[model samples]
Target: MSGIAKTPEPPYYAVIFASQRTEGDRGYGIMADKMVELAYQQEGFLGVESARDEGLGITVSYWESLEAIKNWKEHSAHKIAQDRGKAEWYAIFSLRVCKVERHSFFEM
Candidate 1:
């Protein structure tokens, strides 16, 4: 699966979301796809990476600033999505926000 988000230089923010899912889709896939599409439309949205295996999953979204991240969180559709996550999608989840002070990566 392609989960590589081409991020820019340092000083960006990363919102890391880790979770365990319920047994079946239960409309999670549709909501997730809508979120990805909606995120791209938001300002300061750098990129996103996502991975899932069995019941475990992780999603990382890049942003320009903490404010940008906050805005994304408060988005109306995203709020509904969050509610759905709590009610149906995620069995358990944890979220962490961090600043990218420095990073290095190379691809051949």
Candidate 2:
């Protein structure tokens, strides 16, 4: 599953974050990496998958429950990163949270 995350089985939550970045890195790369590292330390974090090209990026992080998702959203360090994304990194972004009742995968 190369880029796909090997997440825990469903009845899980996925935080789908899609963003359009502004020109220049503005240290966004480092922040994004740090965010991933920090997320792994948080409880209920299952896995993460991300992709980006030409300033367009989409990241999906898996969690055991919505409460865990909420905690991640309110994390102090994550809050700082969010503020920076709004002020410097992203031109615009949208977030969607979905309960993964079903999923499928394939290999070739």
Each model's lDDT comes to 0.93, 0.91
The candidate that achieves the highest lDDT relative to the unseen native structure: 1
Q: Model 2's lDDT to the true fold? A: 0.91
TM-score of 2: 0.94
Question: Evaluated with TM-score, which candidate comes out highest?
Answer: 1
- What does candidate 1's lDDT look like per residue over 29-97, in tens digits? 999999999999999999999998997899999999999999999999999999999999898999999
Clashing pairs in 1: none
Worst 10 residues of 1 by lDDT: 1-10
RMSD of each: 1.1, 1.6
Off by over 4 Å in 2: none
Question: Against the hidden reference, what TM-scores do the models get?
Answer: 0.96, 0.94
As for model 2, its CA RMSD to the true structure in angstroms is 1.6
